[model samples]
Target: MASRALRAVVAVSTLLAAFTPASAQEAVVNVYTFRQPDLIKPALDAFTTETGIRTEVLFVDKGLEDRIAAEGENSPADVIVTVDIARLSAAKAKGVTQALEDETVNSNIPASYRDPENHWFGLTKRARVFYAYNARVPEKVMSYAALSDPRWKGRLCSRSGQHEHNLALFSAAILHWGEQRTEEWLRGIKANLSAAPSGMERDQVKAIAEGRCDLAIGNADQVGFMQTNARSPEQQEWAKAIHIVFPLFENGATHVNIAGAALARYAPHRDNAVKLIQFLSSPRGQQIMAEQNFEYPVEPRLKASTVVQSFGPLTADALLMDEIENTRQLASEIVGRIGYDNGPER
Candidate 1:
């Protein structure tokens, strides 16, 4: 009878151990991200290896803010990772994220790349660059303002004007050129579209290859991905057909967008989330992110991937990202007001 009782007790204990919460059993951080999993796997894996804290990510292509809001206090999200200042600002505005006050995070990221309130921190940056067909537009250097010239009329392609990428870029334009000029500029770009703004940045590049357009606006990393054969072999041929031109404002600096993160307001593992954020901004984490994603690291000390560097040095515009966030709504409004997505004005 004593032996039987001991056996039963052991079984009960094993069952309890098996049912224990994952966090209690071992460290884990849950991430809700707009970024794709494959793009960030290396960084997450390195974080887990370094800190023994595993990461589980949920990739939401859209409606990330709404989902987090719906989950409320019970949200399993410990961190939020996304691209563009607009999305990060949207998360903060939705009250789904809390301010981070960690010294490590503050030290690793520059003031320009982090929220003044510490709501989010940028991990990497990608310049908003122009890709011109080698056979069509020969000049290696170009300006964003030049894209509006009548000479390039009906020769340009872009993704939807309302895309977060373009919105952020337009926001910067608004800040630099003010509303009236930016509006006029949008109309000019609208006049130049080869087709309706119908696809992503990659499609714009493809458009250039197909002779649908001679020049297109896209992020530098997309160009890097193509140049490095990160996509299909055919894409390498497409990449070969174009030349990357870093477009600058009249002020002589190029617009840039960031891939960034924030701590969830209702993080279940707040401490672990802090650790992850710090690790992401650390030298090792920054290196992993920059190399894997083909983006420039937010840490000035780190170098961008070889493919990105081959494009030449980038002088990022000094405009405050917060200012861009402030103007994003107006930027979207202007895109709509000009019928920028309906293709060339008819």
Candidate 2:
């Protein structure tokens, strides 16, 4: 009787283990993202619901590439998300990311918005637009070349030129106008700063509101933040002071930058990582990105947030992102050469 009772106990234990949820076993994907947690949480929650694969996010504000490289083969990271082509290129250049060859990813993302070798894929696009005080600069149209016009001397504000946001714009300048012309343009812009180019995008708008400068350089999403009371009542007041001007390249299209993601080279959960990337590039994912993040979606079929749509139509620069990536180092060199962040020369 004792032996029969022991056998029954063993059978029940084995059955219970077999029926345990797969999610409870080993279903997880780790993400190392430079993107803010709030911006990506909703999409991640949806992914979990659809796939039963839980996501773990580590929001690394800086040194993401260095950390991933240090982990080497033992890294627990399954994917990396970042803003700007510079960081994505840095990840690839540092050997922390691998190429992805998925049909869903390839089909959903435009070639210009992704790496030629598929190392990274852009999820959203934000134009490098101008934020001009409505009362001071009422002309609705402007060009990148025109920011240097003598009439606006000492009337423009910008963030550090070396920052990824400005570097991407400077890189596009190199691609469109060649290095020499771009350098000249940078010097002209440097000469026009009302105060040392400092502060976040919102700060630039605030500067305009405070009468520090008539014009500022910032992205389209910042405009959405300024216009909507979603962030703060003060920001809405800043929005009231400025109007968005889509600055065009001499060739017609405006320079734009992106927020993107890449699969880790040593991803332990490779399939799950792939699914996450595919999901982010999908139309549904794009919609979530638009609504939650207030950025323009990569998928054309997915409408932008109502606030963004109100900014009016945009014509993105035709230069390939890879082209911009190649010019990033040169752009930094020009920033330093021109003393862009040191404020206008006395």
Candidate number achieving the greatest TM-score relative to the actual structure: 1
Instruction: Give the 10-residue window scoring lowest on summed lDDT in candidate 2.
Output: 16-25
What shift in Å separates residue 296 of candidate 2 from its native position after superposition?
A: 1.3
Q: How do the residues 177-276 of candidate 2 rate in per-residue lDDT, one tens digit apiece?
A: 8999999998888888887888899999999999989998999887776676674989899889998899999888889888989999988788889999
What lDDT tens digits, residue by residue, belong to model 1 across residues 91-181?
9999999999999999999899989999999999879999999998999898999988999988999899999899999999989989999
Residue pairs that clash (backbone atoms under 3 angstroms), model 2: none
Question: TM-score for every candidate vs. truth?
Answer: 0.91, 0.90
Best candidate per lDDT, number?
Answer: 1
lDDT minimum window of 10 residues, candidate 1: 16-25
Q: Global lDDT of each model?
A: 0.88, 0.87
Q: What value does the lDDT take at residue 149 in candidate 2?
A: 82
